[model samples]
Target: MPIFIDGHNMRGISPTDLEKIVNSPKDNFGITHLEVFYNESEDKLYCVLDAPDEESVWKHHESFGLKCEFITSVKQIKTAKDLKEEKFQILGEFASQLSHDLRNPLSIIKNSVDMMSIKYKDKLNADIFENFAKMDRSVIRMNMLISDVLNYARTQSLILEKYSISEIIQASLEGIKIPDGIKLVIPEHDFSLKCDGTKLQVVFYNLITNAIQSIGENNSGEIHILCMKKDDIIQIDVQNSGPPIPDEVLPKIFEPLFTTKDHGTGLGLPSCKNIIEQHHGIIRVKNNPTTFTILLPKDVEKLSSITV
Candidate 1:
């Protein structure tokens, strides 16, 4: 069986409409729909189908009044598990490519806006200046969302190495602006662990950034980070002085695409979860003082030697 993948620009199409069209009879098109990749954010769909030829795949979609942008034959290396893994990789690649493409135009717009702001600030009225500021903020938010999506999709196959807790925390804090009213307290005890330092830095970065944002503007707060080791396990806790998450929303905090922040992409905590689990660890959150705790194994060297 030959597997063919085709992409369609499905702008403004509903899920029900897509389902009905895909399930409709082929009418001698000689193709079987295997799976669909729909991205609501981009209004695009990629369908994998089993077909006798590329024409059959084209005719199949055309019969349903849909036009496929492109179609290509793909090789199957293994059975169901391999197909699933390949599908995930394909999705990640698509997301990464789309994000990269979008950044180019966005970068141009950002530069134009910056130049205009600098060149016209004296001539622009307060209202125009405010509007420009708003647009810049929106562009920044969009960039952040794209970054989070890319990170969430590609958070796999980590390169592990030895790192000190203090070093990881310091690296994570780099480039992040901390509020003057907020105080970060880190434990003086230094501990070493064998893990993916880069990915772990992202984990701590998300937690620390979330803590800072939770405190909001003009609020004095303290973030206390502590690390401990007992036997073969090491536990790290990040406690922040901020309002507790709503009881109902607590359970869904780590769920993908779930968020409470107005401009959040909702992938931060989910990415954190993926990174932590990829390291064979567990993360938990509690509310009395708003703490996020991560437990990582001390003996990662042994686990790293075993083939997955």
Candidate 2:
């Protein structure tokens, strides 16, 4: 679990009012309050808590009839960024180390399972084989999530190149299994983009996979893609005709380690945002048709003027 620092705006809040809520008996919400800060000039309260998820933090605040202005998950310390040239080095190092440590053991286990499957195929029953298949799938998913974490932590510069939009999209859809009856409309545009082709491929892949999953179990849906280039910038839109994302969840969808799915690492959108911003590009989502729009500059010289 990670620690989250949430901010709340309370008008005319007195010290006793804050103390009373802070001193209240703790419950089983799995929320531990570390500290609270009050700014007299602005009349804002900042609270830091350690909890398993954001919902628990919300419930902890509601337990005392307190209203929250907003809550966001905290990452590494920013104070170091002001003092040094690099930021989040310690945090990134920890994530990379942990990912490396986990990968070795997972690989060994997967190899062992494969060997057993081959050695005991005649003796193993159907139920045992099914469980083995499930394990292999879990291992593959875990490996993917580890790679996602490493990619998110990377602060390296981009290796930009000139590539066509059609080429990028085609490469991204290589192994993605789109369901039958699902229509994907990709316009034949002859636009060339100067960016990291591999990283951009990742962005499109995630958006496409999410669109495919958003369609119900029936797998009957339509995805519309539109691309345009003007004013020295290229914009790509991916829209899916499926259930719209919840209104409340739209704000927190890009936060790291925040997810609505049962088996998600919550790093997909965050990584996408990081990679795009590193290239001086912008990514946004809109409802009504559930579209993801990516805007990128055609030349690297304009990177300084573009604000991430």
Q: Which residue pairs collide in model 1, if any?
A: none
Local distance difference test values of all predictions, in order: 0.79, 0.79
Candidate 1 lowest-lDDT run of ten: 299-308
Question: What tens digits encode model 1's per-residue C-alpha lDDT throughout 219-285?
Answer: 8999999999876678899999999988999999997668888977678898888777777788999
- lDDT tens string, model 2, 1-308? 66778777877566677887677655438865557887768778888767788898888878767878888887643565454435445666788789879999999989998899999999999999978877876675566566567668874467888999889888777636567878889856759878888777778877887898888546699998899987888889999998999999999989877788887778888888888887788899999899999888887656554544
> How close is each model in CA RMSD to the real structure?
13.0, 14.5
Best by TM-score: 2
- Quote model 1's TM-score: 0.56
Clashes of each: 0, 0
lDDT of 1: 0.79
lDDT of 1 at 111: 83
How far residue 40's Cα lies from its native spot in candidate 1, in Å, is: 30
User: Clash number for model 1?
Assistant: 0
